[model samples]
Target chain A: MEVLGIILAGVLVNNFVFMQYLGICPFLGVSKDFDMATGMSGAVIFVITVASTVTAALEQYVLKPLELEYLRTIVYILVIASFVQLVEIFMKKTLPGLYQALGIYLPLITTNCAVLGAAMLNVTKSYGVVLSTVSGFAGALGWSLAIIIFAGIRERWKLMDIPATLDGFPLALISTGLMSLAFLGFSGLFSNLVK
Target chain B: MGDRLLVTPSPHVKSTKTVQGIMLDVVIALCPAAIAGTVLFGFRSALIILVSVASAVASEALYQKAVKRQVSINDFSAVITGLLLALTLPPHVPLWIPAIGAAFAIVLVKQVFGGLGNNFLNPALAARAFLLAAWPLHMTQDWVNPMTYDAATSATPLAGFNATGQTAFTLKQMLLGQRPGSIGETCILALLLGGLYLIVRDIIDYRIPLGYLGTLAIGTWIFGKPGAFFQGDPLGAIFLGGAFIGAFFMATDYVTSPVTPRGRLYMGIGCGLITLVIRLWGGYPEGVTYAILFMNLVTPLIDKYVVPRYYGSGHDKMARKGGR
Candidate 1:
């Protein structure tokens, strides 16, 4: 039940893109098409999930015992970077099909704030390893859901007669605003349901 | 005489109205509210309006000149944007506030995207939202007492009504614009005249205003009172705040609103529903600007689904048969 609540909270109530305003770069950049958005989302889900588990374990075993908690930011970022590099190599060696699917976006995910944010947030919330993994996977899933829906909307948006000045980023930003407004409905969902 | 017909290309239909003509009509319509706002408040109100309009026009011209594009300053669109932004500001805001708002509207919101016909959101309202976020205290606490022009910090009718479920002003004062609120939003008669003139001159469609105001009235009447249901002051809800101006001017913007008639009606109703929700239950005392801007974002979707039946498609019959 707790895991269910965390997943629900992560996917809907605390969506990384529309709700928390995280990972906006890729949210806007790769959201113009559907297939690319899917690939990007898949890569993110794997990396964030792995990165969260490792960072949580490291904080529990290393930082807490040494009382070097303040260095957690630097440690977590370094772990995430190295972990993504390892994933890239492993995917290329054994799972080349999946590696090519993610292509350039795999490298881009290293800098994505959502990944770093998930790692840091797991530590901040002091989640156990199990909850950390669940929250990270759920956060990435929430991002996938948002990007997919936005991609569908933009696909249809292409045919509409948009004004010249609003053809690109301006229109995209307004669309994000409306999407955020819709996501605002999810606020307090977990709290209301838990009671 | 040789009787040869002139076979022109597509778009054979032509109209006498130009973009400048439409924008000029809007400017003329806004005159009554501008005059009334200045009269009710002091010279500061007039100065704010002038600075706002001038900055908007100047920004557009300067941006175009800098970018080496043909300057379209002759069209009064920037002036209209400036006027709309000024009307939404508090009467006592510093002169720089409107100037900054105008520059943001014209340069960033409108010109950056392309220009007049290209902006996705209502430039004036977006800039107002930006200003509100940047300086909430100045925007909310700078309301001057009407007529006296005293630097009063009294809450507006909507604010008081939302907080205590009551208001000090009566129906007559509300109608006659004797309240402390945004400069142009206070006067119903002036805004009505401008809105009516636009409708009469065929500058704007009537369905948007009617649908927006009607939905707001119904929604507020149904759920306005805090605890008691169906016991809310619908009239006061409609008259107070920026609803009157928003419904008529900002929401009816040509570039941001839907092109089809029915789609525009839906836009209006959607805006009204959002506005009521925000006003009655949300944290804000007013929701006109955000409501309209939100609906503006949805305009494209409305246009997509609410398309008029093609002239001779007859696909409706096949679709019905397939459904069965």
Candidate 2:
């Protein structure tokens, strides 16, 4: 039940982008077109899951034993950067078509705060490796769910005669705000999860 | 007379103002503040700024090349995002913080949104907001004191106001940037000078800043105590933190802000209201970061409803259509 709650909380009530406002750049930037948004979501899910797993191990094994906690931020960034590079190279060699589809957005995963944010939060919250991995997977699922929904709305929005001033980004932002408000209704569902 | 060519109907006239030119102008305008921050904060400031700008430009270039999209790193927008994120950060913030922020700003916010003209919010402000939420201590940890690193952890003027309901620095101290705060936020005069240069160069519209500040002053006066405007000094509040820097440079980002005059006014007013509310009641000390970001999120909506009447279009027709 606790595990289920954690998954539910991360996926809906405490959505990484809409409710918590963690990974908003990708939420807004990639959601313009559904296909691209889906690709970005897939990439984020993969990165978050893998990064969190590895970072948790590093924190538990290396940083704790050495008392080098202060170096976590620098080390995490380097690790993430290298990890993303490895993923890119691997994708290019083994999965050329998949790599071609997500090629442009792969390097983008390097700097995504969500990846680091998830890893950091895992350590900060003192979650066990299993829980952290669960959080990572759920967080990515939540982000993917939110962006795909947003993209669907935006596709329909293309037909509406939006005013000149709000035609592009402004309208998208407003919709996001409203979506946030809508998502707020789910807050009560996961109230009994984390604590 | 034998062969008069016909021009296609669209984007009627082309101006010399390319994305690259606008971005270059922004970089030039930000140079003064960048220099001031470095001079005051020491070598780490320059190093952090360099890393941020480089990371952003590199990410943008690499992403474009990988995706087969047009490479836009030369346009300097990514450079602007990097510098702005660096300026907003505490000088002592770990290198990775700025690096992460830059990546968030450029790859996630700017490039992923379709790049350049397509982003919905100012990338730097969005990244700052993310960092603030993710690491409140690191984001709010003040290290701007000039003399000693030990005493560098004091609250900023805004944080002072939020925590104890009292400002340690007087109006003059705060205005002159003598107070402890973010590196770029220390010198009000420097920020204004840079802002004025941008305005003069026509790099940014003056309406957004003016409207935002004006509304903020009025809102602070009304909500605050009788002398709060004069005593706490609303103008001081406006100048103290990232308000001016954010209002002029970050909030008025062309892609994120409104296009028409009226839309811009609404955008400014919305930001002012949000900032004031958060400052007075929210958990955070400084609200400019979230205020600008929240407004950036709503900019699209503001532009939608605040459109000017088309020539000869009936008001009723527009209203009926808008109501849908």
Candidate 3:
């Protein structure tokens, strides 16, 4: 039941992109096209999941023992960046088809704040390794859900006769604001079981 | 010969109907509800409506002038948005609530997306949701008893229903707008007349309303009771809240709903499902506002996948992928 709460909170009730305002860069950058957005979603899900598990393990095994809790952010960045590299190489050799679909987005995820944010959040929330992995995957799913829906809407901009200045990010950000306003309906709609 | 085959710009279907004419028809249809709301709630309701519509028109004009775009306030869509937003608010709110809401609707929701036809979300519904979030007490607690004109508490039928799963108001009272709710929401007869007017004039698709109400009725019947099934009052459920107004006016807006018939049906059903979930289990007493807004955002995706099969289209899967 508690696990269900975490998953539900991550995906809908407390979505990272819409609710927490994380990963706005890639969310706005690669969301102009639907397929590209999905590719980015796939990359985010993989990286955030792996990064969450590794960070949780490091927090438990290394940080607490050495009293280096303050170095956690720096250490998580290093872990995420190197893991993205390792995945890029390993996928190129073994899963070349996926590499073709997700390769262009993997490097972009190396510096993504959502992955790092997910790791830092796990530390603060005191989530163990397994729950942290689930939360990471769910948060990425929620982010992916938002961007895909946004990309679906943005694709229609081709059909519309928009203004000169409000063509790209200006319109995108406005739409995001309205969308988050609507998503606010979900905030107190359910119990805060995750906490 | 030249007269018979004139070379006019394309859109050659012969019709006197226009955007302006359709919007005028909507305002006309909304009159009965607006009047009933004013009569039931007193002059305060009328002032709110006027302020909302005026501010909405002003916002559109001012924004267009500031941005050097064509001022399209004469088209009357802003009036309709303002009327709808004001209608959904609790009666006797501060006049500025509707004013601010109207501006938010016109400027942020409608104009930012390049004006009336281009916006995907319903402007009025979005504004109402904004107001509800920004000022929960006024939006929820400002309701008054229909005739006595006093601030109502447990007298609000929807809240009573939400708390006890049972209603003290009779069906006739609920139907006659004798109870307390949002300004336009209390008078079922007036809203129905407006909806019938829209349907008769072909301003809205009938299937959208039918699907929305039908799904809500069935869901209410199936899950309305605490432990029993198929024991809920579908008629009371439809008449108690914004379901009537939402189904007829807001949910069926052509700009935000699907272009295809099948997609509109799905949109209505999706709205009904979400409304049921919220009313039954979620925190809010009414779910129509959020239900409609959520479907409005999903509408583009529905339009994408529910594309009508064109003539001579290939059956090949890869062909379809390449076509999109």
Candidate 4:
């Protein structure tokens, strides 16, 4: 039940993009088309899940034992970068279609900040390995969900005869703002459930 | 007729302004504040700013090169992002902090989103927000007075107001910028001078800054503190903290803010409301950064919904709908 609370909180109430404002670059950029958005989300989910588990284990077993916790940020960032590179190479070899869809976006995941932010957050908040993995997976899933929904809205929005100034990026930003406000409705759900 | 037929769909008329031009204008506009920061904080501040700007530009350039995309460092957008991020940071922050911030601002917030005009939020502001969240203690640690090197850190005027319910700096002190705050946000006079230059050069439209500051003034006049409401000069509120810097430069970033006049007005009003709310009630003292950033998230929506009516379009239908 407590783990469920963590998952729920990370996924919804404390969503990485809308609520916490992490990973907003991809949230806005890749979200123009639903198909691309889903691909990016899948990539983020895979990277975050693996990165979190590795970071948690490394922080707990290696850094803490060596008293080198201060180097966590540098270490976590490098790990995420290498991991993303590895994923890119592996996907290119084994899964060409998936690789093509996620081609440039794969490298982009290294600096997504959400991935690094989630890894660092896991260590900083002192979540155990299991909880850290769950939080990371949930956070990525939440980001994916938010961006996909936004993509759908933006696609529909293309039909409207938007004004001159507000036509492109401005309209998208305004829609995101409204979506953020709507997401605020879930703020207390986890807290309430925990009690 | 052949050439006309070959023209691309829409955006038929192009402005003289390119992203490079606008970004260069901003960098020029920020020169005054950067000089002021260097003078006030000494060589270290200048070094930090240069490092940040260089690192941001380098990171952006390298990222584009590595990805086999067009290298866009010449646009000067990365420099502006780095400068803005450095200006918002504490003068005494660790060397790695600014480097990290610059890299993030350029690579994560700017380039990864498709570079130049593609970024949805102000890269500098987003980097600052991230640093604030990740390292709150380091980011929030107040600096000793540059003149004294007093070893004892003191709260900023805004923070002082939040804690003790009294501002440390007098209105005059804040106006002259003798008070301690972020490097560039200290002197209202400097910010205003730079802002005026931008306005005069026609580098930026006045709608965003004017609307932002004007609405903030109105909101502060109404709800600033009990007596502050009546006694509080809205102009003072505008001058305090990074309100002026953000309103004029950061909030008006072409890529992140609304393009339409009506959308800009609505964006300004929203920023003002959020800033006032945060300053008055939220835990943070200076809300301008977050307020501007929060509003950046909404610029797309504001542009979509608050579009100006077509030239010569009748308001009768809209007016009747509103009445109903």
Candidate 5:
């Protein structure tokens, strides 16, 4: 039940992309096509889940005991960056198909705020290691959900008769606004279930 | 008359309507509300509208000339945008507010994005949102009394209702535009006349207005007042704030709204739901502009998913599965 609450909170109630406005670069950049969006989402989910578990363990055992909390940001980024690198090399060796599908996005996950944000959020919220790990996986899934759905909707505009000026980024931003509005419906969803 | 054989592509049957004609009708439709606003708020309101309109037209022409694009001011779309921007403003804001807002609307929101037909968000509402964010005090707390035209810091009816579950004005006064609010949004009757003219002329789709008002009325009736669900006043919710103008004018904008009939209906409902959510629970007293703007963003999504069935593309599984 607690894990369920954590997942719900991370995905719907506290969405990293639409609500927290994190990882917007990848969300917008890779979202123009459906396959790319799914590939990016899969890579983010893998990295985020692993990075969250490792960061939780480090914070609990190393940083907390040493009282080196001020080094949180740098440590978190270093941890997430190394984690993404490991995933990239591992995926290239073992899962060549996915590696090719994700292309540069797998490496770009190091700079994604959502990964670091998940780790930092674990510290700020003082969540336990298990819950923090749960949150990381959920947040990445939430982001994937948004990007995939957005990509599918974007394909519909391929043959649309649009105005000359609203062709690209402007239209995308507006579409994002509406998606965010739809997400707003979930604002109080976890209030009853989660503390 | 010398006869010349002409070879033209599709759309060989052309209507008498042009961009200029449609925009002129919009301007004419807006006159009742504009005139009412001026009569109710004194000459300062009129001056502000003029300044906003002038700034919008000048900005468009200047930007086009600067960018070496053909100056399309003859289409009258800029005039309508300027007029719409002016209507949404508070009557007592400094002249420079409208001027700056008009410039931002034209240059940033409309022209930079491509031009009149291309802007994703409604230029006037986008500018209004910008002004609101930039000058919250001027936007929210600067309402003048309707007839007296004095600078009174009284809360609008929506604000008061949000706080106390009751408003100072009766239904008649709310409908008649005898209230302290934005210049053009106060008068429900004027807005309705304008809306009716557009609908009758077939210039605007009726589904959007119907869907928006119907959803809003139902939502408010169910959950308008805080604690007293289903006992809430629906009429007041529809009449007050910018709901009337937003539903009729802003949400019904062709470029910003969905092209298909079903998509348009969904847009209306979406706007209504968001507006109700904001008015009832969100921090803002008015939600019309943001609601419409948000719906404008969703227009493409709506158009995609709610695609009308192609004629005679009957029982084709591949066609049905294509959206996935």
Candidate 6:
């Protein structure tokens, strides 16, 4: 039940893009089309989950004993970058179709602040390995849900007569703002039951 | 030639009613709630409504002029947005709250989305949710005593109902809008009249409201109580909170709702599900605004996948795919 609460909180209450304003660059960049958005969401879910596991393990084992917690950010970044490469190579060899589908987004996950944000949040929240992985997966799900919904709205923009100036990122940002406002309803959600 | 051939967004069904006609009917339908609110919440409520409506129109006109577009404020959609937003607000809020909310509704939610018929979410509800987020203190705490119209901060009956699943007010009182709540929402009688008028006038779809209220009734009946099954008060549940007004006015907004008949049913059901989740277990005492707003995000998705089969088309894959 606690794990479920965390997942629900991440997916709806503390949404990555709408609530926390993380990974917005990729959110706005890759969410132009439906297929592309789904592809990025898939890649993000896999990468963020994996990175959370590795980062939590590292924080638990190396940084805590060595008292090198200040270097955690740099170390985590290095670890994430290398892990993404490993996934990329592995995917290219075994899953060429998915590799093609995800394209550059697979590699781009290394720089996705949401992945880094989830890892850092795990450290800050002091979540153990199991909880960290769950949080990471949940955060990735929230981000994916946002991009997918945004992509659905964007698909209609193709037919809308929006002003040229407010056509692209401007409209996207405004729409995200409105969506975030709606999501505010979920703030402190399940406070009654979870506690 | 251009004037003869009109091109509009989705909802392409031919109708004798112009946009102005439909919006005017909506205004008329909403009049009962507005008047009931003014009377129930005293003169301050009336002031709030006026300020909100004026701000909304001014914002629409100013935005149109700034953007080099035709001023569309005369259609009364902005007026409706303002009225709806005001009705949803607590009566005792500083006048500027509704004003800012009205401006936010028109400029940010409506006009920025290409104005009437183009907005993806119900502008007024979106703005209400925005205000709730921006000023939680004012939005949640400003419910004045309904008839006495005093400054006493009375918690809505929903707060107690949330915990005890019991109500002090009878069905007669809830129907008469005697309970303490947002200015307009307390008056289920007026809102029902308005809803009936809209449905009778063919200004709004019946399916959406029916599906929404129906689902809310059944869901509340099943899960409204803490432990018992089928022990919840469905009548009290629907009459409470913003459910009635939201179902009849906001959820049925043509721009934000589904176009297809079947799709609209799904929209209402989706709204009911989300509202029940939030009110029951998620958060908050009422969930109408967020339920409708969240469903607004999925309106397009519903439209995409839930299309009705074209007449005379076979059920084959190619034939089924022909409508799109």
After superposition, candidate 2 runs with Cα above 4 Å error? A1-17, A20-195, B1-14, B147-151, B163-166, B225-231, B312-324
Clash statistics: count for each candidate: 2, 8, 0, 8, 1, 1
The DockQ of each candidate is: 0.16, 0.03, 0.69, 0.04, 0.21, 0.74
Any idea what lDDT model 5 has? 0.81
Candidate 3 deviant stretches above 4 angstroms: A192-195, B1-16, B312-324
Per residue, candidate 3 scores C-alpha lDDT tens digits across B1-324 of 012111122335575667788889999999999999998998899999999999999999999999988888888899999999999999979999999999999999988878877787899999999998899888888888898988876646775665555687787887788888889988999999999999999888888889999999999888887788888778877889999999999999988888787898998898888888778767688889989988998888898898766645555666778876
Comparison by lDDT, 2 against 5, better one: 5
> lDDT per prediction?
0.82, 0.75, 0.86, 0.75, 0.81, 0.87
Candidate 5 residues A82-152, lDDT tens each? 77778788879998887788757877888888888888888888877888888889989888878877776
Can you write out model 1's per-residue Cα lDDT over B1-324, one digit (the tens) per residue?
A: 001111112434565767777888999989988888888887898999999999999999999898777798788888999999999899999999999999988987777655666556788998898787678899998888889999876767797675555567788888778888898998889999999999999888898989899999888877777787777777787888999999999999987888787998998898888788667655567888878876876665576578776655687778787997
lDDT for model 3 comes to 0.86
Report the Cα interface RMSD of each model, rounded to 1 decimal: 5.7, 9.0, 1.2, 9.0, 5.7, 1.1
Tens-place lDDT digits, model 2, residues A1-195: 778877887886679988777888878888889789889989999989999999999998999999999999999999999999999999999999989888788898887788998898788779878889988899889988888777765653464333454456766676576456434434454254533
Residue-by-residue lDDT tens digits, candidate 5, B124-220: 9988887877798998888899999998777777876755556667888988899988899899999999999999998899999999999998998
The estimated TM-scores of all candidates read: 0.74, 0.61, 0.93, 0.63, 0.81, 0.93
DockQ of 4: 0.04
Q: What TM-score would chain B receive for each of the candidates shown?
A: 0.92, 0.87, 0.91, 0.88, 0.92, 0.93
Considering summed lDDT, which 10 consecutive residues are worst modelled in model 4 chain B? B1-10
lDDT of 3 by residue, A45-121 (tens): 98899889999999999999999999987898998889999999999999999999999999999777899999888
* Model 6 local distance difference test score: 0.87
Name the regions of candidate 6 deviating beyond 4 angstroms. A192-195, B1-12, B313-324
By summed lDDT, which 10 consecutive residues of candidate 6 chain A come out lowest? A186-195
Worst 10 residues of 3 chain B by lDDT: B1-10
State the local distance difference test value for candidate 1: 0.82
- What DockQ does predicted model 2 obtain? 0.03
Task: For candidate 5, give the lDDT of residue B314.
Answer: 70
